[model samples]
Target: MSNNTVVLRLARSDDLAQLSKIEQTCFSNDRLSKRSLKHWLSAKHALFLVATSSDAIVGYGLVWCLKGTRLARLYSLAVLPAYRGQGIAQVLLSELEQLTQSKGRAYLRLEVSALNHAAISLYKSLGYQVFGAYSDYYGDGSEALRMQKRVARYDGKGIRLQVPWYKQTTEFTCGPAALLMAMYSLDTKVALKQVDELAIWREATTIFMTSGHGGCHPVGLALSAIKRGFTAQVFLTQLSALFLDGVRSEEKKQVMCTVHDEFITQAHKLGCVLYEKPLELDQLYKLLKAGGRVLMLISTYRLDGKKAPHWVCVTAIDEHCVYVHDPDLDASQQAIDCQHVPIGLMEFSKMATFGKNRLRAAIAIEKLP
Candidate 1:
């Protein structure tokens, strides 16, 4: 087959049956149903593409633009067995990636069975990097490797500011992990390792957050940064004790209070500035633009389905959105595992609050001038 003869175009309603047939023929398990294919073919914020030869469908690729973030997911891609090795899959992927980038998405992410060496090789050849793995991701108990590719965008110049990212090793360490990223961005000499991560967690942990070992409060995290010789400024909308609503026991509340008191004393002693009002989004943008790093507390419900407070680093900001380095890693999705995930400013503002108190906290850090 000649490459020039292959036709690539957006899938239509009539192509659903052929796409479903290709799905059934391509894999033993996790095949998309005909109904699902039909729905995705017409769904908003999604792209269904087909590659045809001689007016017959040979392969298809499905991608989803994640709402509220400048990222896209390659939900599935498949080529007919007999059509394999004819460059059909490559053609489909190339067109899909270009379509996604043209929509202003910065990353293309997908998951494949870890045992599928052929697919993995093809993805790597196309510059995809494996960032995480999930056990038993499929119905057949097979592991899946999450991979991502950066959709490069240049404004006739260079790229955005690159910020270092580190994933939290434990569930309760997102604050410390995010803090470490901000600290590292401000001072590259600061080393990041398991021990340092644990140490920072110990220093900043509130003893009890919503559940597990208490997450780091904004004051605690700011103290950790200050102790590391970085100038830290904390912005909080409320002055009340942090994370007290989730704790029912008076003793636990007192412990939280004690921790908050210690952070306040340390802040006063070290001359760390603590703003009693919320950090305006514009201020955050200005800080990032002025070579400062910000660690923000956000509700994970926006990124994942979990309604929990999580911390992430503000790496860069553009005209329409802010780029974040999320410390919490999702094994099943590699885009969330990578750095510089773009979140729209309005969505970010809505996601930055926690609890009934609507607590909004952020810490901006920079090396001493």
Candidate 2:
């Protein structure tokens, strides 16, 4: 349950059957044909990676490495339902970046549906910036946001350590670093020298981060990162999300609180910093000055009253600027001006209700180290 236990190497031709199944299960009506999967399996510059749990494929990703340069394109990524909150897709992504970077790739690119907020948020949190949107990019005429990330050069020699996926477990049990010991004992049959390939559905009652749910659920990922000596935290807010897809109104507070508490506790136990409510602009600036990466959870309310509560990551900040994931924006650019962004704090807090009282407060910050 902890550690970068899953080994990500190259996908073999035999993996076509499983990969095809995943594509079908993940893409709904947009599933690719077996023939297409075969093409990707044999792709020369493309790398396919499968996330396995005791040999069963749980997730996958595909990346296209440019032939003559260090640029790579992330074509597709997915993780099965039961395996999602575990951060399997992220591991596959970070692995692809490592694979491409090893090949001298400097830039990473991908296109996501304009409505797919989860993908947009994850990529931005991982250091990707948006460029622009391609109208009607999908066959169904849906728009797509293009995103890209620049990989830092590798200076460490020896074998590079594989990164682990962050998981959210309700028990708030074992940390990821300790969980890694278990992962290291697993068998790795993957063949590394071969090419790589890439390939989530929302299930109900399972707690979606995008939906505002108040409860104390541990973010397994922060614990995993802490175990590895990396400062990791989960970000959440008390405000209602304006655009969540599948959560109920009464459940929002519980979902958000649980997710927030879990990440904070795990981060603290792992020796990372934890920040709770009443966070001010000065406190944020001070944290950044301490010389570490911080994940800020900002809340957005849907003034239109049709969407659910949501949150985004604050990746960068300055006196006059704040850079965030802003899943609502197109993915091909770096940051957006705070003034033009969606759902400000004041607009979000007004949605919360305590018994007969409807509060207009728009913001609350809980920091996890």
Top of the candidates by lDDT: 1
List TM-score per model, in order.
0.73, 0.41
Q: Write the per-residue lDDT of candidate 1 for residues 1-369, one digit (tens) a residue.
A: 236777888899999778888988997898899988888988888988888889999888899887557788999999888889988888888888899988767778899998899999999999899977779988899999988887746432222555777888998898888888778877888887778888998998889765668888888888888889888899999866887887888988998999888888888998789999998877876787777888899888866667788898887776556778887766644535456777766778888988889999999888886
In order of listing, the candidates' clash counts read 2, 53
Which tens-of-lDDT digit does each residue in 1-369 have in candidate 2?
A: 222555565788998888888888888655668997799889877888888877877788898774433357887898887777777878889888888778756567788888889888988889888866778777788888877776636322111122122222222111221222122212123211112100000111224434333211223333443443444433323323312333455576466456545545545666654333334545545544553333332223332233232223333344333333333322232222111121223332232321122311111122223
Q: How far in Å is the alpha carbon of 114 misplaced in model 2? A: 1.0
Model 1 misplaced regions, further than 4 Å: 1-56, 64-68, 75-159, 335-337
Could you tell me the C-alpha RMSD of candidate 1 in Å?
6.1
Q: State the TM-score for model 2.
A: 0.41
Work out candidate 2's RMSD over C-alphas. Answer: 20.1
